[model samples]
Target: MESRPSVARPFYSTFADLYDHVVTDPVGPWTEAVEGALASRGVERGTLLDAGCGTGRHAAAFAALGHRVTLLDASAELLAVASTRCPGAPAHLGDVRDPHLPGSFDVLTCRGVLNDLLGDADRDAAVRSSARLLRPGGMLALDVRDVGRSRERTDDTPRSTTVHRDTGSAVTFTHRSRWEDGLLVVAEEHRERSPDGSVDVQEFTFRMRPWTEQEVHERLGRAGFADVVTGPGVGGRWDRLFVTAVRRA
Candidate 1:
């Protein structure tokens, strides 16, 4: 079977308003885990870059912990929400693959960003860019889909879920995913009905390339990072591969 080319809709732009509602990951625990890793490396608090900081969830958490947090994401809308959410934190609109930010930081978190880069070059560039943005011996933490686990538990069935909010608005999300050429392609549709019965529909397609543990180790090493350590999923999700590394001094 061949994969068809479709226009990539601006996902975050349309999904920003519904993000906090739909995404219920345990952000506090995830941030604490990353902070623990930093503490073990002797870093109490310093400059931190939240790369691909969607809606600044983790950024806000880091900021609340007294770290000087900086935000970066490709989506302007999401960045805006994050900026407002974490007031006083510097925000940059950029992609993690080539984040053009100023200054090397003491810590960088690129959570849930790498899998979105379906191409090898892009993924490599992202890791290298992360290294470039960190000072010598700086720490980096990120998560990606675990290729082996994900493949063993592949679910190709189409599914739908409807979420109703207390504000009298409801959104029905339908999605179908398949593996194509070793990459996961997901097609999603979101239909929202307002209190006045006005309805809006948005459709988008996204692809992800899960990484094997070996590949992650090799890539981090090639990107000028050392002391690479793979950890359990940040929020206890078995399908996620959490990793930490330090920039070579």
Candidate 2:
């Protein structure tokens, strides 16, 4: 499969609205890793930019922690959702690989965005661009998966859950994910039933490339980041590869 930059935005646009509900959580494993990494680097509060900020989960968390947060994503629908998450934060509708912002940021976060590129060149461009977006001595915190570990998995993980809010309706979501051709692809079918017998079925597909920690480290180095470190992913073993690096002064 070839890397199609043309389909990246469209692929994300289809399910951008359901991002916060189904994808990332502000207090979830991702937040744990990112927040911990930021804390370790003594980044308690500063200017922060979340590149590819889907629904602004991480951006909102940082903002609540006293950091000035900015959210950026290619899909406008996602940006709209991010607006609700980080109400006053500036949301930019643009690709992270080509971000246009007013000034440099102290911390740049590119989570859950790079692996989707699934191509060496495409992800590299994003990495280089991320370094450029940061000020000297600023840090880039990003994550990827272990493609080799995912490749060995033979069965699809099936998950079913129903979530209910304080009022309105209930949403039952079924998730099915499998690995194909070095890509971890997932399909989510959501069935929402309203009170008045109204039912809506929404389907969303997502794919990410499981990248080794070494590849991520090298990419960061190529982007002029020094003292790169590949920390453990969200879970133990070769699960989530969280890479943190600082722009060389």
Candidate 3:
């Protein structure tokens, strides 16, 4: 394995406890898409691996549906949240591309992660490793950002926005974003308030590469996946792209 250049840890680790509240329906949309894909492909009930499963929401959903589930993530804090969410379900703390499992899975999922990768080599490694973790004929489902459409925006200035709300504990979110040189970069600021009026705050910056549909198809094919299919992505959003590929039998 090539040594991947170090990148800052994603927001998942920095604000794990607040993840479910901040991200809109993280698992519901993905689970629905994955279930639909599996049903269409006649795959029902099997070992499922959730790669880059930040809070284990998707894995928990599958486990609830009677499929044995395993989860992998790079963030230990996120993994802790996952373990609590899906008790008894196996979870490992590591990169999705380097999940240490004794055997391959019948189905693998990697949603909402590829676009955030900071390096091209890391992206390629993730694809190859996802392919490696699946049994021949198994399924791989994932989503990607619609980079093609994002490039349509002509604005060069960064956009800034913030949201603050109280639901038991006060929470605040600040975001600044802009597109630059084929990458969408964002600076995120988060603050959580205690009842005593004390506050915890953190800031992180992340970059996501826009991925075209054709580029996605080629990447999966190169990673040894066949019968690749693309369609509308999850979240009922026309912006993202969803794909399902089968490991070459």
Better of 1 and 3 by TM-score: 1
lDDT of each residue in 169-204, candidate 1, tens digit only:
888877888888888888888777889888877777
**Best model per TM-score:** 1
Q: lDDT tens string, model 2, 38-124?
A: 778765558889898877777887788788999998788888888998998988988776677678889888766787787677888
> TM-scores across all candidates?
0.91, 0.80, 0.86
Best by lDDT: 1
TM-score quality measure for candidate 3: 0.86
**Model 2: residues >4 Å from true position, as ranges?**
1-19, 23-44, 152-154, 164-170, 193-204, 235-238
Candidate lDDT (C-alpha), each? 0.85, 0.75, 0.77
Instruction: Extract clashing residue pairs from model 1.
Output: none
- lDDT of predicted model 1: 0.85
Model 3, position 174: C-alpha lDDT score: 62
Tens digit per residue, CA lDDT, model 3, 34-57? 888888887666999888888887
Write the candidate numbers in order of decreasing lDDT: 1, 3, 2
**Residue 15, candidate 1: C-alpha displacement in angstroms:** 2.5
lDDT: worst 10-residue window of model 3: 1-10
Clashes in predicted model 3: 0
